[model samples]
Target: MPKYILFGDYCENALEKRTPYRQDHLEGLKQQKETGILVTIGPTKDNTKVFGIYDAENAEQVTELIENDPYWKNGIWTDYEIKEWIQAF
Candidate 1:
């Protein structure tokens, strides 16, 4: 499997209206991690950005996984970009 990074920002209105769902979103990611779909995930320390790393067979698989996320499906994220990543450490 290869690894990729997903970079995104939360929609302002969604952030304001769905605080509890935000926690659910994170819990979902944690489940994915336990299932071996997610390598890691977190928000930037300053809180302006968010990202996730995943181990997948290909970019399309990664896209499908991300697109199905409650956060992405509910418009919690305003924008996102995905890129193949090389993990040296």
Candidate 2:
């Protein structure tokens, strides 16, 4: 498997807008965690952006995972970028 980093921007007023889909988003993340795909993820302290690290076979796998997340489907996440990572730790 390869490691990837995800950077996502939230929609305007995401804190308020995300309320309805929060549960589903969390549930999807939980399943991804259990399946060993999502290594770690969270929004920045100010909630300006979302950051995540993923372990997957390829970028497409990670893209599909993110695309299926409720936040993305519901427009809480406006856009995102994925990059193959080289972890030096």
Candidate 3:
């Protein structure tokens, strides 16, 4: 599997706007984590951005995962960019 990085910008007042969908969003993340696709994900401390690491077959898989997130559907995430990453430990 390949690894991908996700960089996303939050909508204006994302903290407040995200409340309605937060539970769904977290649940989805949990499910992804259990399936071993999501390595890690979280918002910036200031809540302006979101970052995620994913292990997937391809960029398309990661893209679909992000696009289907409740935050993305409801606009808590305004936009995002995905890039294949090389992880060197």
Q: Compare the candidates by TM-score and give the number of the best one.
A: 3
Clashes of 3: 0
TM-score of candidate 2 relative to the true fold: 0.97
Give per-residue CA lDDT, model 1, range 9-31, as digits (tens): 87765547557567777787788
Instruction: Report how far residue 27 has shifted in candidate 3, in Å.
Output: 0.4
Worst 10 residues of 2 by lDDT: 65-74
TM-score of each predicted structure versus truth: 0.82, 0.97, 0.98
Q: Which 10-residue window in model 1 sums to the lowest lDDT? A: 12-21
Tell me which of candidates 1 and 3 scores higher on lDDT: 3
Model 2 sits at a Cα RMSD from the real structure of 0.6
**Model 3 — which ten-residue stretch has the worst lDDT?**
60-69
TM-score between model 1 and native: 0.82
Local distance difference test scores for all models: 0.80, 0.95, 0.95
lDDT for position 64 in model 1: 86
Of candidates 2 and 1, the better by TM-score: 2
> For model 3, which pairs clash?
none
